[model samples]
Target: MTNRPLPRSFTHVDTWVFDLDNTLYPHHVNLWQQVDARIRDYVSAYLKVSPEEAFRIQKDYYRRYGTTMRGMMTEHGVKADDFLTYVHAIDHSPLEPNPAMGAAIAELPGRKLILTNGSRDHAREVLARLGIATQFEAVFDIIAAELEPKPALKTYRRFLDLHGVDPARAAMFEDLARNLTVPHDLGMTTVLVVPDGTKSVVREDWELEGRDAAHVDHVTDDLTGFLQRLLPKR
Candidate 1:
């Protein structure tokens, strides 16, 4: 992957907020498979639906609610906390500590935070598996943030306010392009992590023309390399 210059807006930031899940780890590992299975089981058991029906309904609910837990809570009357606990109970052994990523994160110049649409327990598990759980100053997960997920401008704003962060000075690194839009609007420098040889599917709502395209400061195949370029030597 090619290295790019850091955006001018990046110089104004003292904190970096990172998205968890697909952002912290590589996507091809299929780490979400276990979680997906748990979600399906929960749906089948609680909703009393057939496994086939549960799978179909779970997919639809995720599409509608932005998360399976959220859909379960709203439509199936499942308790949010219970659903979160159940769905995230999968083993995280697939995630081996990524020394390269851990080193890069260790060398970052400013405070770091994990912003995720999952429960704090899930985030902790992932981070611990990656061997970088102690690096971040704080974690703002769905429950901590009152269940408002990412790509929501309000959630981003609340995160900044809660952390006393200035958007103009902060940078957000995320795997999803759509999640970058809200931070970009809030004056934060946005970096899109496009894993090696991966092509990002343009969402129906994504307007990728002209100035809108410029809102994304950089795109990199690997976040470790991206951080090496953007952050000064520690």
Candidate 2:
């Protein structure tokens, strides 16, 4: 693979979109484990089932509905608001502040937004913990997407409409390659934020596709470095 400067596709980007969780932060922190456990607990309690059963159900819902919240809402009539509030309540302390990432993002000449399947509360806590809370123009959360999770065209379409974003002038960065497909189809340049070491998408994102060559325009392990390179040489 050629080591190139920021491609022409990204040079004029007027809208920068990012996915929270493993995308903004690296995967080694395993902050997701905390949320995963919390979600399992919530599932167990809500379903009045054993932990193992809850785990099985959660995975099924994740595969079929894109999120446990969506599955629960559809089948169990669970309250999306309450579920989001509960699952995102875990301590966000695992994520330390990254002033470097903050600076890189601020240097980008565009509206910066976080498009995530997580709740606004979770996104807020994580961004504040990362010291990049103020760098974003908006955080379009799962709640804002009406509980339609990513990889779904509807959520991306909703984000475009709500933000008045021109996909042709935008670029999207995500940890999961599959999530980038819709954005690619919507005319946004797609970048995959690869995790360190041999790991990539976790088991929870069971529907994640490894087909980066088909939809992704760029791939990088260091998001800070990647963002820095996107800035025009001064």
What are the per-residue Cα lDDT tens digits for candidate 1 across 33-110? 788889999999998899999999888877676677877877767788888888899889989998888777877778
Global lDDT of each candidate: 0.78, 0.87
- TM-scores of the models, in the given order? 0.84, 0.92
- Model 1: weakest 10-residue lDDT segment is 202-211
State the lDDT of candidate 2 residue by residue for 1-234, as single tens digits.
Answer: 856334337866899999998889988788887888888999999999999999999878987887888999999999998998888888888799999999999999979999999988889999999999999999999989988998799999999999999999999999888788889888889888877666554544433445346678888889999999989899
Q: Given candidate 2, what's the lDDT at residue 175? A: 81
10 residues in a row with least lDDT, candidate 2: 203-212
Model 1: lDDT to the true structure: 0.78
Per-residue error (Å), model 1, residue 209 = 14
Distance from true location, Cα of 188 in model 1, Å: 1.2
Error of 1 at 54 (Å): 2.3
